[model samples]
Target chain A: MLSETDISAISVTIKLALLSTAILIAIGTPLAWWLSQTKFKFKVVFEAIIALPLILPPTVLGFYLLMTLGSNSPLAGFLEYFGGGSIAFTFSGLVVGSVIYSLPFVVQPLQNSFSAVRIESLEVAATLGASNIDRFFTVAVPLARSGFITAAVLGFAHTVGEFGVVLMIGGNIPGETSVLSIAIYDHVEAMEYSQAHLLAGGLLVASFVMLIFVYLFNRHFSLVRSRDW
Target chain B: MIECQLKINLEGFTLDAKFSVPDQGITVIFGPSGSGKTTLLRAIAGLEKGDSGFLKVGDSIWQTDDNFVPTHKRQIGYVFQDAGLFDHLDVSGNLNYVKKRKTGLKKVFIDSIYTLLDIESLLNRRIGQLSGGEKQRVAIARALLTNPKILLLDEPLSALDLKRKNEILPYLDSLHNQLEIPILYVTHSQDETSRLADHIMLIEDGKIIGNGPINEMLTSFEMPLSHSGDAISIFEARVISRDTDFNLMHLEFNGGQFIVPDNALPIDSLVRIRVAARDVSITKKKQSDTSILNIFPAVVEEIVPEGNAQVIVRLTLNGVVLLACLTRKSSASLKLDKGSSVFVQVKSVAILN
Candidate 1:
């Protein structure tokens, strides 16, 4: 059985994952659409920047993000300018870290799917009297529905399983910034073997379930695309 | 009238076009593949922004040097070669998608287009299940639902086979006759051009080579269409009488009456008659005891030598000119020259529209 702090950490993890996934979808869709459509010479450079977190070491990313969002940093300065406290060691800081950590998981699927949304379809929509925004929502989004599910699930799972960035930024404050991964880590460090097993087992089960959903969804979507129905 | 001037710098070529097409009939932009036919039509539809251009459809200024109108803002219905329809939508869904955008909806317009295209049974069908011709008909119906001021077609029949092309040609002809909307139809097919175009613009290598009324352009010796071995002259005529005994229809034009295989088009309806140059023969007198049906008096107007063996003879009957592509041996045998009076024998005639 998990303790009070463990249950609270699980709730915090769910909250952080949901909020980060929501915010990522809002920002990532337009960015992904632009990335897919642009043919500029420097587009590859922009793509590499977006994908840096994918290949970079998690600790390395955590170290730099710590400096940028720490108490002494400019973002904290901006917070204080509005009579707010430092963003460091807060739930907001964890959310900011989770969003960055899970960004590639959300954006890559979306960008790939947006690219696959045929330009011909959008042109037809425009010729049929749809504006750019209308086409994005009506035609592009519906056509890329599977990609949305994949992106959202990956974003949520990645945020839920994030370790290094959350550790550096959130610092394991139970009921506030502590998440399931960090709580499990704390249990391991304290030699609380039973507690660690419980939390780890739960996360393992949850992650496996999420992956099953994604793979099945991908298979179904590809079948539809190939008209295997 | 649709007046357009466009300048675009594509990767390997630059398209520079200037032409005014009549607002009442089908104006064909005929050219070979990769000749900027589709590019020029897109520029007119305001889908492709050119380096510089001026486009005016009737009174609306769609484009100028700096100012521009987006495609959705322009009242243009463009039908692509592949019949680009939304796969997620059913046929009725596709039609409603455009119909919902219009501020004004007319039941008359909807009823007429549905009946005209013969797509009433296809409203609930999925787009994925439609055959090529059915999809194109749906696309046209969808476009018409918008009540577009101008209609643009980019080789709408290129993806279909001969059977489908024949099936859809009559509907396109009906559209040209019934709707007063200016249609800028692009095609590489000679059959479609002869059948539907009232005005023809011949494009090659991204340039407008020749453009005029269909009759003048087809007859002009300098035009690209005139140089073909299969060059044809079109006669605007009306159905006067039908012969049940011979199963032939009589069409009356300025020069004389010509008979064709009986057609289903009603009496007194205007039809285009295409006389291929090779189907005509010249003699000094109207010969009898032959299988030829159309024989009329004509004067040799001009004779331009073609290839190494043939001469394209321009003959005038009354005031209407017809072209006869005869070999050099035949021309010399008949002693045909400019101002020479002769009787032309007809072998075959095609009823186009």
Candidate 2:
């Protein structure tokens, strides 16, 4: 019963979530690893900054991102110098906003998992002739596999459910910036209750499934950890 | 030879140690808790970066002025107290981790190490399925496959209970002569020290107080080992014969022959025996009517008073060192002095290996 525009919106939402999650994982891994290992005095400041997106209103973050990517900003001017147009109200700008909005969703679990990796294990790997990078990939990454799964699922699910940030920076451009939540909002505003229910029910089911996966993964990981001395 | 002069300065503690140990056998770093023994071992492995340090193992320098080789680059194997095995890997995976890292090591040699540590049957099991002793054995086999020039074990048996410690000690004892590399073992247990150490380095208050072969270090009056209430002497002997009727074995040492309760070991096999200072009594003449079977003529070399009541007498029997603890009153009443001849009556001898 969905219209063609609604179908396009679903596809765009999935694409945006996938791309944002890929970028977040690529960048969040080292950041989380550093957060877990650093002994610096000011590490708490960085931790608070990363966690800001969690407590902050998404509209506030979207408002700032809008200003930063708008035609008047230096970022747009620099991109324009490289033959690119203003990113505001575009799919690229939607991705940038979604990445920042869901950063803590990806990074916090990863940092906790990396912190749980015992220092003794890493030191043993080093003595066994594993270099720093080798140790990170072979020991730290595999040991934190549950964290990676949780982070990816949460980042993708949170990005799919994004409403305010996409609305503020992307402005509901069909097939480009218009996503599932925006499409559902449009249906409710037009008083089309059946279409609203369709999208909203789908999203509710998807989010619940993702949460169930995360909890199951966490349980399995804890059980495995307890088996080790 | 492994030569080291390392200094580490922490918030309230400092570790300054310097010594040279032979590139063979087990050299125990003996100390009480919080005495910087672990810190010294870490520095040698390049795990703890000292403020200023110099370490040379064999001909290659690991750390020195303006140069430092990181832990991965240094050819040393380290075993932690908890075994530190990879929980994500099964037993075989843990053992093969080092094999995958280092190329050109023979598969046969690695298999021999597996057999030596008795972990062949455990290759398929998960690390979590292993008992405390099995985990340590796998950890040791994993380290040996790296073909290191020196092995560093930081209280490898401390995490295990007494039953498990006994289970793993034989494997550790065999590692001394089986491998050519020097092994630096850190332990606070006197039993482990006397059982394993070929050389001993005494640490106290973040400094090296004494360093020598285990025989001299254990019996030296100037050292703290002989002054303790549980002081002991260890000696090597060869099984001469076994009296099956009496359940006894005749053993020959550098000092004299000893008759011990039979252990079923074959004749001509080398064994280690421990004689605690408290188990020895001294008399002016050899007692012929006593039930004690082991008596030898010895000369007093030195006497160290242990508090106000007891004295630890260092004796030399046929050039072999032995320790005897006695009441200071008995020593004075008997007029025991340096170079005084006495008959040492050993009450019992415990076979260590």
Q: CA lDDT, every prediction?
A: 0.89, 0.93
DockQ of 1: 0.57
lDDT of 2 at A86: 86
Model 1 residue runs over 4 Å out of place are none
Local lDDT at B257 for model 2: 92
Model 2 misplacement above 4 A:
none
Lowest summed lDDT window (length 10), candidate 2 chain B: B42-51
TM-score of predicted chain B versus true chain B for each candidate: 0.96, 0.98
Superposed Cα deviation of residue A78, candidate 1 (Å): 3.1
Best by lDDT: 2
For all predictions, the C-alpha RMSD in Å is 1.9, 1.3
